[model samples]
Target chain A: MILVFCELKDGQIRKPSAEALSEGRRLADASGKKVGALFAGASCAGAAEAAKFGADVILTAEGATLASYSSDAFAQLLADAVKAKGATVLLAAATAVGKDVLPRAAARLGAGYASDVTGLSMADGKLQAVRPVYAGKAFATTTFASAVQTATTRPNVFPAAEKAGAGAVETLAAPAGDFKSVVKEILAKAGGKVDLSEANVIVSGGRGMKDGANFKILEELADALGGVVGASRAAVDAGWGLPHSMQVGQTGKVVSPTLYIACGISGAIQHIAGMSGSKFIVAINKDPEAPIFKLANYGIVGDLFEVVPELTKAAKAMGIGSN
Target chain B: MKILVALKQVPDTETKIKVAADGKSLDPADVKWITSPYDEYALEEAIRLKEGKGAEVVALSVGGDTAKDVLKNALALGADSAVLLKGDGQGDAFAVAQMIAAYAKDKGFDLILCGNKGLGGDNAAMGPMLAELLGIAQANVIVKLELGEGTFKAEREIEGGSEIVEGALPAVITAQKGLNEPRYASLKGIMAAKKKTIEELDAAAVTAGAQVSALALPPERPAGRLLQGDASQQAQALLQALKDEAKVF
Candidate 1:
């Protein structure tokens, strides 16, 4: 069986986790394997959604102790589930929580694990993984020598399949029911519809955008794409964008998407680490020599002030807006 | 209070990359090395904490001969002392973390700081792996950190939002960009860095379980085909590419 760690928050399946579930379903189909999902929390809303996405078995733990994420507790719960089902391969979304807990679980099982994987397949009864290194400038093909292989997939890179079904559900005992810490308050941005990390089309600004007010240009393009706006560390550091929480780079969030439009952002290696895997890269910068143009599948050497607005209008005319 | 910060030296982000003729590693000839960007934030936070709350900051780094340059930069940035885990410049995340964790265990520090991730090898695994190795509490990609009497409060970024976590003293936290503003090295500090003590320790015991098999540049991008239009027209072109050419979206 191939098992997925279905991450949840406030009774909803995090979009990244749903993408992982969808990818897991694909892997199961290719290898003739069973699909199982493990989630730890009180909410069942995400489980139903995972079922619709092709989960054959859903394992949930709803204890209060499991309400919040603790590396030790989550690792323990996942390790137990993986063992109970005799899963050959385990998958998780390469989100913050997965990065925090999966390594510990890999250590617990004494199994080697790969991270930030963009592609996966079963080859000759072993799992073959492809991941980017050196900030996406290079791709490495790696195979797991361990019996049970583990992987974390980048979000939005894999589309969620919509095959409808209600999978079997099983509730398990929560591990370490009482936590040392609990979330007191979560102060997230109010309009959560277009999270940059999960957006299919991301329009990002950088230092070249000049200031916070100039971000409106990227926002206009993002609106046209039905996606969220992103920024580089330089823009975030200059207070042109939110803090590191919204920054995309080596120190920020790693995002893989269908379309990543970088505006006025001289692609720093660190910035490329996060989004280099985006399927189609469109770089718009006044500087023709900017590093981003080297990796861009499509390059526009013009002022973003002049180009982005036109591009946004063109996108809307195409009627291929973000869903 | 006393803090330990781990720093590293890496090629400048804008440096032109070249693979070694041998195909085993990056070409070192003419490559300029600088302090990792994230490490600057770590050192800055450690110095600010010491200045505000009366603490001492000790910096550590593991690298080959070129690493000494980064160690000196750390000294100029306000670390009271420094240590270099001398090696062949081939340590993986696990090996580097183990060596640093072992040394930190003996220092009796109240807190530990590290860059959330480094450009070299570009794996963000060291901080968390080090926390696990040291059996210490950990918070990653911290956008905010507050240190008080025997405890630390931090905010870590999640996919769609953020999570606030707390841990006791002697914990480990990786410094994210907005966690603190890094300061420039003063002329006096630059001169004084010449006199600071940086002890070099042999690190043959550090074992990196994995190795880099080869280094190669990514496939060259296909020549760009500019899409022209207003927003709607561009959207149509992109959709066509997704369906007929790229087939990704």
Candidate 2:
């Protein structure tokens, strides 16, 4: 059997988790094994949602302590599920929560895990995965031959596959790990609609954006395209953007979205390390010498100040803007 | 108080990276090494704590011969001493953590610090994995840190949020972008770094887990076509393409 660690939050199903479940089902089908879904939380409300997404068996780690994510506790729970289900493979989303918790789980199981997998295939009952290393500068073909293999898929890389009905839910006994750390409080930024990773189209600005006040242009373009606004490391470092969620590069989030629009970005190598994988890239920069033009599928050698407003107006008039 | 900061030598952030002949790694030959940026924040924060409370700050790095350079930067930045685990062969975070934790076991340090992640491999694995191995409380991407009587208070960045965590002394913390603005090397500090003795140790394997097979530059993005003419013409062209060709609004 193959297991997918279906991540949940606030007693609700997360889109990334749904994508994981969908990918897990694909892997299970290829391996001819049952797809077991694992959820660690205080309640099983979200576990039931995984079933509708093609989960065959939903394993719940329902306990008071499982309410929040503790790496050690969640790893033990997932490891136990892997053991109990006799799963030969496990999958998790490469989100922030998954990144923190999965490595510990792999360590507990003493199983090798391939992370940020952009490609996976099975041959002769062994799993082959394509993962990028050296900060997105290189790709590696790694094989996991252990009885069980684990991998985490990048968000939005695999579209969520949803079906009609919920899968079968099986309540599990309490997981057996004591967690010492706790989340005292969480303070989040004010509301925004687009998720940085999940957005199909991304409109990003860099240091050339000049100032925080200039971000309004990018935001307007993003709103018109119904996309999220991302910032480069330079802009984020300069305090023009948030650090946590912004997709910077190489060391930051690797996104392979459909359309990536870079405005006033000079395309530093470190910055290019992250989002170079987008299917279609558009660069809007006044400086014709900017390196971003080299990678742009469409290069606009005009002032972003003028280009962005025009782009926004054009998108809105075309009915692509915000509802 | 005593603090230990872990560091690594990575390619200068501006280097136009070239893929290694093998395709699974970068060509290390022409790349000039610099201290990983995030580690600088860690070192600075440790120094601030040491200066404010009269603490001892030691810098540690696990890498090949070149990694010693990172410690020199740390010392120049204000670390009391330096340690280097020399090895070019790559080991996963677990092994690297084990080497550091083993060294840290007898050091009697009150706190451990490192960058949230390094740019070299970009896995962001070592600090948290080390904390786990040492059975110490940890928080990553810390924006603010305060040393109290017996506990350490920190603000760590999460996905789209931030979390406030409190832990006892001897905890491991990873410095994030906004932790502190790292200081530039002073002339006197640079001279001192040249004289600083970096205790070199051999790195060992922790686990035979993930291995890199090849490296490749990302595929090139296609050239973009501009919608020329006036605003209305541009809008019409864009709309026509969306309705007929691109199919994306």
Candidate 3:
């Protein structure tokens, strides 16, 4: 059997978790094994949502202490889940939380782990994965050397699917111990915008945005396209967006949206390291010699101030994101 | 207070990655190696704590003699001492963390620090894994950290926002960007570093946790097409291309 770690947000399974579970279902089908969705929290309220993704069993590590994520506690829960289910493979989304917990869990279980892998396949009844090294400049085909094969799937790279399953809920005892770490508080960003890592479409600006207030135009265009607004390192450093949260570059979040529109971003090699995985790239800048055009699928060498508004108007006229 | 800072050396960010003659790894020749960017933040934070509270800061890394350069740089940055865990410095996150944790498990250090992730693998796993192995608490990818009496308050990055975490002493703190600006070594510090000895210790032999079978670059993107005409025409054509040609929307 394969066990998947499910991450929760507002008591609902996040998209990346669903994607990982979907991949788990695919792996289970190929190997003719059961898929177990492991949820570690005070409640398994949303475990049933995994049904559409074809989870055969829903294992909840429920207890008072499991209300929030604790490195040691959650990792023990994951390792115990794998042991209890007799699962030979473990999978999770390579989110901030997933990357934290799975690796610690692997250490405890003495398992081989591949983090943020874009490819997974069964080879000789074992899991093999392909992950980007050097920040996506190179790819490495990774194989596990331990008995329990564990890997974290990269977001927006794998296609999510739906298949009916039991999604049967089963409770396990959460590990009890002195959890030395605790989350004192969470400060949510204003407006509750979609996170850059999970967004399907992204409209990113750079130093060319001119001023922080000018980001409003990018916001307008992003909303019209049903996407999110992002900024390059220069803009973020210039306080153009929400500190560094909206930054897209080597030093920031690495994203692979389906449609990426770069406005005024000069395309530093560091910035390209973060978004090179995007399926399609559109560059809009005044400088015809900007390096961004080299990697863009389409380049519009025009002033972004004049060009972006026109694109927004066009999107609205075409009813692109009316739904 | 005693703090241990762990670091790794990786290719400079501007270096165009090239695959080696071997199909499964990076070619070292012509690669200008630098300390992983995040590790600089880690070392800088440790040095700040030492300067502020008169603590002892030691820099540690896993590699052969060439890796000593990282330790020398750390000393020049204000670390009191340095240690090189002798090994090939190969393998995944587990391989690196195993050597460091084994060496530091009983060192009685009050705190541990490292980059949230290295530029080389960019896995962002070693900090939490080291904490787990040493049975300590961890705060990862933290941009703001405040050391308290036997406790700490940290602001760590999440998906769309930040979370404040509190943890006990003897914890692992991974440094993210915005933590602090790493300082350049002064001429005096460089002279001082030249005289300081880097203690080298043998790392226990361990098998790699993961095996690499192949290495390859992503398929090249087609040559970018420059749109023709003025702003308005380009916008119209872009919409048409997105709808009909690229079909992204």
Best by lDDT: 3
CAPRI band for model 3: medium
Off by over 4 Å in 3: A238-242
Question: What are the runs in model 2 whose C-alpha is more than 4 Å off?
Answer: A144-148, A163-166, A175-178, A237-247, A251-253, B89-91, B239-244
Model 2 chain A weakest 10-residue run by lDDT? A175-184
Instruction: Provide fnat values for all models in the order shown.
Output: 0.31, 0.47, 0.83
Cα error, candidate 1, residue A295 (Å): 4.2
The alpha-carbon root-mean-square deviation between model 1 and the true structure, to one decimal in Å, is: 3.7
Q: What is the TM-score of chain A in candidate 3?
A: 0.95
What TM-score describes the B chain of model 2? 0.92
The residue pairs found clashing in candidate 3 are none
Residues B59-102 of candidate 3 have per-residue lDDT tens digits of 99899888899999999989999999998565678878888989
| Descending-lDDT candidate ranking | 3, 1, 2
Q: Rate the local accuracy (lDDT) of all candidates.
A: 0.75, 0.75, 0.88
Model 2 docking tier (incorrect/acceptable/medium/high): acceptable
Per-residue CA lDDT of candidate 3, range A1-323, in tens? 99999987777889999999999999888988999998887777888888888999988877778876777788888998888788989999988788888888988887878989999988888899998877777789998888898999999988879899898888888778578887778888888887898889999999998999998999999999999999999898885455777889787888989899999999998899889989999999999999999899999999999999999999999998885
Weakest 10 consecutive residues of candidate 3 chain B by summed lDDT: B204-213
Among the numbered candidates, top DockQ falls to 3
